[model samples]
Target: MTSTHKNGLSPASVETIAGLSAGLISTIIVHPLDIIKTRLQVDTSSHPLLNSSRAVLRDILRNEGPTRFAALYRGLTPNLLGNSAGWALYFLWYREAQDVIRNLRGYNLGTQLTSVDYLAASSASGILSAVLTNPIWVVKTRMLSTSATQTGAYPGMIFGLRAIYKTEGIRGFFHGLTPTLFGVSHGALYFVAYERLKEWRKVSKKDQTLTNLDTIVASSLSKTFAGTLTYPHQLVRARLQTYDPGATKRVKGPGLVPLIQQIWRNEGVIGFYKGLFPNLLRVVPSTCVTFLVYENTRWALPRMFGNADDDPSNRTTVARKGERAL
Candidate 1:
């Protein structure tokens, strides 16, 4: 029998809900950091000090006038939509893929999955979610990279999409897709570190499941590790997706290889990590909130809605075991 939450939702549905909720809440809390990160990534100023998070944030607030505070959340609508949908799809696909692999392997209930399983499942899920949601990301990058004072700045997500469609056609929405796909390694690394960290904590503490604090710490560390190593791809992707408000033709930018070469030639290796500081600041807490909310929501939903006994962790043998399956 297919296991369902007490609320009559499948486990996958519950996970999707959790992911959506997590992304929505976390994005709202940390959007200002996102704006800073995006601006820093696209900034090509020769002076390193000019590109610092503090400088960028101060510039926005001091110069943007009435829109200063609001500017911190410039692309909020698309960002919210993209993150909520992306995380939802990622968790759903990841959990389903893990189940498929487990069933194929004939693993018994509550069997611990290997790191290889996590890599495969996370990679597949990341690629699928990244592909499906690239358009929203393109729109978000446009809104964030464009100053509020810019002539062709989009007023909202709908307007942004319509503008891109009219001006750049459907192809505009998939900008930077190549680097985005390559960035899947980031997610794979994150999940592997996350699961392994939880396992290590459980072993050290002699506990079967981790506390909420443990989950937060694990996610923060995992995000740091994955984000630091794979951050260059994000910089490249952001640059490729940057909007040119003055352009009438297709959004023109260097291809993946040439762009990387350009950054290398002009800015050196540090250019690829332009926003690492603010990104880590944003992503670490954002990841903590996401995993914490996801795990807690999954735990609470069934009990709050109907069945108090539907433990999400034990749903399948290959279900994430330690750290409350966050």
Candidate 2:
């Protein structure tokens, strides 16, 4: 669609489309790390051997043989569906929330939205995305841990959900709701840092927009900081998502602290961050790609399609009130 609704595309739809494209591309390129990150977090192997991205890569090469590379993408279908929907909904909610907040406060594109604004918007977006996509992720996690020889795990999204429904009932899809809800704090921290970094760059450069490299640095740093702080919750979430037959017998309460305590007692404190390295490896680059693609698409689409929004001098006419410029 060209600018100004000429080709019938709304700004919200454009943002969604851009997010879908970016998420798919990033997932395709970096998913092996994602797989490794999940496996490491969920793996009960002694001492967490799959610590490094290289180690995971080495394992795939050593153990999988000819299908080694393909093996790395074992859960690509669930991943693509889950991630695509998450990004699309994230941007949708994020943009709408920013618009509402901007209207309430008279925030201007003439000046930037504050980091607080970003954090609030991102927190809402993260929760919405997580709730809607949790089932897909439960299936995805099972797929990731599924062995090539194991016929127990379902083959696709529909089958996986059906199996979970049959075996664990309606509550099965929300296996990790507690830790996942806790993980929304990660988004709050991430967007605050990222938005502030962008603001600082613009002020330092004496410019209205950031260069691509500046965007990358901000996105990477923000991801690393938030990812590291919240990684333990992620480990908890991954473990929670899987079916634990012993959980009912062993764990005392059906609450967050008990889960943490269970993990602590059995696997120790290190269990909560088993895959931090590989997760960081995936987080930094993938986050950079997401913002890079988003920023560029938001800027390029308008200019290419002649939407006055991207005209360097005209901030007011941008499709979304607080849409990132350049």
Candidate 3:
């Protein structure tokens, strides 16, 4: 397809819809794994790292009985809310940044997008989204990581949201914002790497169709690499989010630095990566599915939603032969 007619969707809308769909679908698919990952990360015990996946399953079966799927999806509500909001914002910001960069660089619509441009767009979007949605994520993490005893209902997403608001007030929602922002750096890195890898794969194969498999591979590799590199921050974020403010006085909330020091003193460096293996496994597949779904949805939405030029939401004044703005 030529640049003007390519995909027939407005770039902006395509990105937004793709991100929303992908975030929602991927969250639902992988939420159980996510809950497990969170629990493993926040355990804070002196015991050596547990077999995260197995432990998660065991805990679910033991506590919730055989029908433990409900336990697995403990925080589905907060996850859906956080993920959908995060991805939608990320895509919108990323596309806007790309447009600004393209216009400033005087790049034509048909010109092949450079690796630098993609990285810049992805990083900007990821960081912005991370900052905006950190609070929601904090609440979600807290809800997911806590035991049923703490939550009183094995809490769905709504329960978590209500509990936070009722117990801790609105500020409680943002408990882990600092660590979450730090963790967002990982996301920025992941997106940049994913885009570059995808470009390399396409160039090597001389195929630019960006197939489903391609998206999956790119997303998995990118998330794995980035997730591993930045895992400590994520662990810290989860810990801080789930830390009980009302716990006994012996448990001091000394904030981020002290917590890090305490964890280091108590558990050592390996402690930071308590759930790394399961996280790697979960994140790779989850992210891969997410990006694959996102790209495909972007490709399909124009056909389903009508032409980009006619849609005011698209904001494209001129259409080239095979190019769509996104």
Model 3 lDDT per residue over 1-326, tens place: 11334446666667777889888988898887787778888887744455556867687767852367666776677789789888888977877887788788998865655767777777788778887787678768777776655525434566556776776678777777787767767877887787677667766664344556666677778888888899998888788777563453223356999989989999899889988877787778778767766766665566675663533223211122253322
Error of 3 at 264 (Å): 1.2
Q: How many residue pairs clash in each candidate?
A: 1, 0, 13
- Per-candidate local distance difference test: 0.84, 0.74, 0.71
- Candidate 1 — worst ten consecutive residues by lDDT sum? 314-323
lDDT of candidate 1 at residue 199, scale 0 to 100: 83
Residue 260's lDDT in candidate 2: 82
List the candidate 1 regions with Cα displacement exceeding 4 Å: 1-7, 49-51, 315-326
Name the best candidate (by lDDT): 1
Q: Name model 2 segments beyond 4 Å from true.
A: 1-4, 45-59, 62-66, 244-255, 310-326
Q: How are the candidates ranked when ordered by TM-score, highest leading? A: 1, 2, 3
Candidate 1 lDDT over 201-256, as tens digits, reads 87777435578887888899999999999999999999999977866666467888
Worst 10 residues of 2 by lDDT: 310-319
Candidate 2 scores a C-alpha RMSD against the true structure in Å of 4.8
| lDDT tens digits by residue: candidate 2, 147-167 | 444546556778878878877
For candidate 3, give the lDDT of residue 266.
Answer: 91
- TM-score (C-alpha, index-matched) for candidate 1: 0.93
How big is the positional error of residue 81 in model 2, measured in Å on the Cα after superposition? 1.3
